[model samples]
Target: MSSEETLKRLALETLEQDADRIVQLIRVQMDNLTMPQCPVYEEVLDTQMFGLSKEIHFAVRLGLIDREHGRSILADLEKQVSDVHEAYYEHREQLKKANK
Candidate 1:
């Protein structure tokens, strides 16, 4: 394909990989029983997500990716993160119920 198309594809792949890293991080924290409300945890997540958003914005402005595609990437990551939180909470609740 054309050089422009190659660059755009690379940009999208990089963003998706970064998003996967964030998801893996959250999963690791949940596996280790790190409290979601912990200040450090919150800060790390906020910082990482903010950085990703900036990167996506840069790619969009560079014409390496479209605005809607960038948004979709972020939205998918957010939904995955939310699902992780929900699963963690549900598991915790089950543990509590089992103990009683």
Candidate 2:
């Protein structure tokens, strides 16, 4: 493939990897029973997401990735994060009932 194609492929891979890392971080927090409402948790998620969006914008501006694809990546990440949050709450509710 051409160098430009290679660069685009690398950019997409990097963005996906970054998104996966964020998901992993959320899983770890859930596993550790960390409170999702904690300010630190909010800050971390906000910062990581903002950084990823900037990277996506930069790639799109450089013609390294399609605009729609970048938007889809962010949307998918948001869905995954939401799923994790919901799972955490469900787990907490289960624990409460079990303890009673």
lDDT of each: 0.97, 0.97
lDDT of 2 by residue, 22-80 (tens): 99999999899998899999999999999999999999999999999999999999999
lDDT string, candidate 1, 1-100, tens digits: 9999999899999999999999999999999999999999999999999999999999999999989999999999999999999999999999999999
Model 2 C-alpha lDDT versus the unseen true structure: 0.97
Superposed by TM-score, candidate 2 places the C-alpha of residue 6 at a distance from the truth, in angstroms, of: 0.9
Stretches of candidate 1 above 4 Å error? none
Q: lDDT of model 1 at residue 50?
A: 99
| Root-mean-square deviation per candidate | 0.7, 0.7
TM-score: model 2 vs. ground truth: 0.97
Report how far residue 36 has shifted in candidate 1, in Å.
0.5
Q: Superpose all Cα atoms of candidate 2 onto the true structure and report the RMSD in Å to 1 decimal.
A: 0.7
Cα TM-score of candidate 1: 0.97
